[model samples]
Target: MNDDRLEGAGGEDTEEHLLRSLPGCIVAAVGMVGIAGFVLFLVARIVRSLTT
Candidate 1:
């Protein structure tokens, strides 16, 4: 028999999926920021080295 307790199943599933994915999203955002920072640092170092 079909389950009655899971009424509005689509919305519930979407909410649960979003909750599970939230951490991965945060990690991805942080990783992007970190990579950007590192690239900037490398570029600055290269520029400084060339000038010197």
Candidate 2:
């Protein structure tokens, strides 16, 4: 009952898995960048408030 069409079949290391996971990785990277930008913006605002 081993079908090649099935994915995540326990200890399977294939290129298809990498391809399938690529989009998730990209989204995660974008989210991290967005969070970093937000934090920087908040820090800048705090700095400005302290100076003024």
Candidate 3:
């Protein structure tokens, strides 16, 4: 029952888990950057409008 081929039976599983989870991390990072950029752009536009 301890064969390496069995499910959830190796350090490789942890590495695989992390690899699978990487996409979520990448998506979150992109979303955060996009939101930050959008907010900053909006703020800059508002300031420009106010000054004019």
Candidate 4:
């Protein structure tokens, strides 16, 4: 009843907060992946140079 309605309202605020921040979260994830890939690529190149 009244408690249920208050709970639902709180849920909506959390949902909206997540939706607002989702894009920033996605961009940070993508940036981290890209940085990891670049670091791996550099390590491979260095190892190849050492072996050859």
> Which candidate, 1 or 2, would have the higher TM-score against the true structure?
2
Q: Give the TM-score of candidate 4.
A: 0.78
Range of the 10 consecutive residues with the lowest summed lDDT in candidate 4: 1-10
| N/CA/C clash count, model 2 | 0
> Where is model 2 more than 4 Å wrong at Cα?
1-13
* Candidate 4 C-alpha lDDT tens digits along 1-52: 3554455577766676667668989999999999999999999999999999
The TM-score measured for candidate 2 stands at: 0.71
- How does each model score on lDDT? 0.79, 0.81, 0.80, 0.82
Best by TM-score: 4
Error of 1 at 26 (Å): 0.6
User: Any residue pairs clashing in model 1, and if so which?
Assistant: none
Alpha-carbon deviation at 4 in model 2, angstroms: 11
Error of 2 at 15 (Å): 1.6
lDDT of 3 at 52: 100
Candidate 3 least-lDDT 10 residues: 1-10
Tens digits of per-residue lDDT for model 3 on 17-45? 66766898999999999999999999999
Top candidate (lDDT): 4
**TM-score of each candidate?**
0.69, 0.71, 0.72, 0.78
TM-score-best of 2 and 3: 3
Which lDDT value does model 4 have at 4? Answer: 47
**CA lDDT for candidate 4:** 0.82
Q: What is the per-residue lDDT of model 1 for residues 1-52, given as tens digits with 9 covering 90 to 100?
A: 1343354365666576667668989999999999999999999999999999
- Please give, for residues 1-52, the per-residue lDDT of candidate 2 as tens digits: 2343365564474577778778989999999999999999999999999999
